[model samples]
Target: MTERTPTPMDLLDFPGAAELIAAGGVEPPSAEAVDGAWAAVARAAREEERATMPATPPTQLTSRRVRRPRRLLVAAAAVAAIATGAVAYPVLDMGGEPAATASASEFFEGMAEVAEDAPATTPAYWKVRVETDNQDDGKRTDTNYFDREGRVWSVDADGTVHEPPAGEEGKVKKWPVGKKWLTWPQLEKLPTDEKTLAAHFPKDPNTRFDQVTIMLEDSPAGPELRAALFRILADTPGMKLVGDVRDSKGRAGVAVEITQKSWVRLGGGGGGGSEVTLHTRDRYVIAPDTGLLLETTHKTLGKNTTTPADRYTWLEVGPAERVE
Candidate 1:
């Protein structure tokens, strides 16, 4: 009987063959894929060597063998890891959301420049056109008129003047101006350093979100500080761009939003029957060309329901003026 020699297919059926093919490809295989393939080859080599090594062998691989299935398995794994959509697909879901490709960093950086060049004429007051909407309250628009002297006032469509009850008069009224979140002096002192500005944001998700949005649409942070504020928001954790959107005023702009999950207690048991996490999403719209903040909207989503909690629109016509 004639002894048979193993064919090339038998040799290539071992673990290392895929690595050679990948190396010779038009494009180089990824480091991760290469490493994984080599690891598989080493493991198979060790197992084959252990199973068939002779006390004195004619050659190191003279009696070694690799199963067809094992070779195919390792080759498939390496290919999967190296393929465009296989192992790299999970990167899209980082932070439980799609990663931002075109970051807002440049937009904010440019806005900061425009802000720095803005005239710093201190007005006796600052006025903004304000509109708010909710499911229960419907929609209402008002001209928020106020002065640094702490007097607050609002004008309705009929050109009616509304004032706080004399006794309710405080340093700042809560309806509009007070909700602006940052005063002129405070905005002036806002840190431009990215990390510092991010740190200055409140820990509470609602407040942190409100403060940031207000800074964009309504805060007296001026141009430089406003630009810094936009950068801070861009760097905020969990914040992601929601792409293009039109503000309530129908101006085209870019929208970015952040979602936070929190546990809320429901009354049922002696203490509280159970707690469920609620997801709150907030979105902000900014003009892409001019970098002006246009709108901010918030939604609260529960297991089976979504609520449009708050929406605000700000048209930044600077310099507060007395109501006509």
Candidate 2:
């Protein structure tokens, strides 16, 4: 009688395989079972062949055991591949450039410091001249003055002082009569009310006036004039105080600068305001000892259709005498 060799399933029981079979699923035998089955089949075949052949030495069977650690190592390698894919996903939309940095507050603070140092004050009498050189017209000069009591006067090219009408003159009755060196402290004591200032200057362009001379009558007080002349400087944006120093006239002074936008009225019709932007690079020399404006130079740009680029050269402050 021939003896049947045991199958791999009979050598070891595998719980997972039995459960899968009960669930109506086809499951392969465990690795160890497959290895044993192959070995048993080989031995049985060898015995059958030996019986039919001449006597020969029985062949030794060798088994190689696969460790559980080696199987785990293979599984870990597969999991690493999946984890690497998850980590390498790209989602950033960077244009491959670094971002720019900026500080608006710091920049504005620096500008304020410069503006505060700008030379400004109410002079007892300001001997100012406005010179213009236009391609379509010949060069012209306009010389004017303002007294301590807010009186306005002008000197013609022939060196003649022209006075306003009696009605307007009464507005500046308390103004200084003769030329004198008026300090800032003295000017500050005078009224700076907008109505009082306008009374001594021309009405705005929108207002009524025939010739530029009539507008120069220095009467009919208006708020626009004060804004154009003094308030604009006092409330200038981006103006800042820099430091103190002595001016060319040997007066202790404060330095200031301004780079900001402002408005001013021109002509005499009570006209609308014109926009002005100034970038004052030079330091304004203000007499610190007397709180008077000494000298300054500023570059200005006008957006008004009637105006153009220009530079204001403030000079003759020290030697010139004030008349209020």
Candidate 3:
């Protein structure tokens, strides 16, 4: 089997993770109740520009590329943590001094600032190109475009351009949220304020975390909406900071993770073996400079394994090409 390499940043990647997910026993993680940011990628470059002017202070430092600070804090969150109480989280701040501890609320709030300050665009089509590094499929990069009318256009790795119908869903689809698949307009109408956005989601933090991932990845959510979502993620309890790292493409970023566990009973004919538990870790790496999601990694770890179950490295997300 093809294996993913382990970097120094795999702090939350527990050894028991792979047994459950690899065996199809575990459900999910950070994708779980307590976890994880996307904006700020735009701000990295913008932050540099702003730094030259000396009016605004950059939340992420200028040296994430040279060396990574300590793996500051770990969240003691359980896979089945409840929604009523907040789990204490040790936050990692990318902008300033390194420490053994900090406030997670403040860390993600920095992300919220960058999300709001990111450069704006009103492109003809919202385009995204992502490369999926799957254990079985090897590797393939695909391009997608979403038009103003909510149509989807796609291009395969072999350069096959698949055009969308004038006003139909794209070949792949858009915004898969909860039981409802939302069109572009409906997505635009999503609540942007913190309270309303939180209330609009399921009260279950686990479900809410996954739904936010869906919106950030597939929907054409604006900067303000993205900012609010960042704040909401900050409010989620027991989030771990995985420290500075790079995506498969070798882009600089910070990783955050949450874990999920599954337990199964093992038995032989007329004999009972001990129950075994497995884990799945969901991790996101965000570029501190650009404030974009550089990668999303999901994996189950064996005693000495580090290969990821699913890996997505976002190569591009901007305006799609216009074909005559």
For lDDT, the strongest prediction is 3
Better of 1 and 3 by lDDT: 3
Give the Å error, residue 185, model 2: 13
Worst 10 residues of 3 by lDDT: 67-76
Off by over 4 Å in 3: 1-103, 165-172, 262-277, 302-307, 321-324
Model 2 clash count equals 27
Tens digits of lDDT, candidate 2, 82-149: 32222121111214322111111122222333333444443345455655344444456666665545
Q: What is the C-alpha local distance difference test score of each model?
A: 0.59, 0.37, 0.61
Clashes of each: 2, 27, 14
Q: What is the lDDT of residue 97 in candidate 3?
A: 24
TM-score of 2: 0.26
TM-score each candidate.
0.60, 0.26, 0.61
Q: Residues 179-259, candidate 3: write the lDDT tens digits.
A: 677776677788878768787777656676778766665456777777788777777654566677877888888877767
Better of 1 and 3 by TM-score: 3
Per-residue lDDT of model 1, residues 1-324, tens digit only: 997896766555645556655655455665444434444444544465556645664465531132222445455444544543233221123354433322343334445555555665677667778788989878988686666644667777888887644655544622222234444565666676656776777655456656676656765556656666666654445555456788878988888777777787898877758887888887888776556668888789777876666888876546754554
Tell me the spans in candidate 2 whose CA falls farther than 4 Å from its real position. 1-142, 145-149, 168-237, 240-255, 261-291, 294-309, 317-324
By lDDT, the candidates rank as: 3, 1, 2
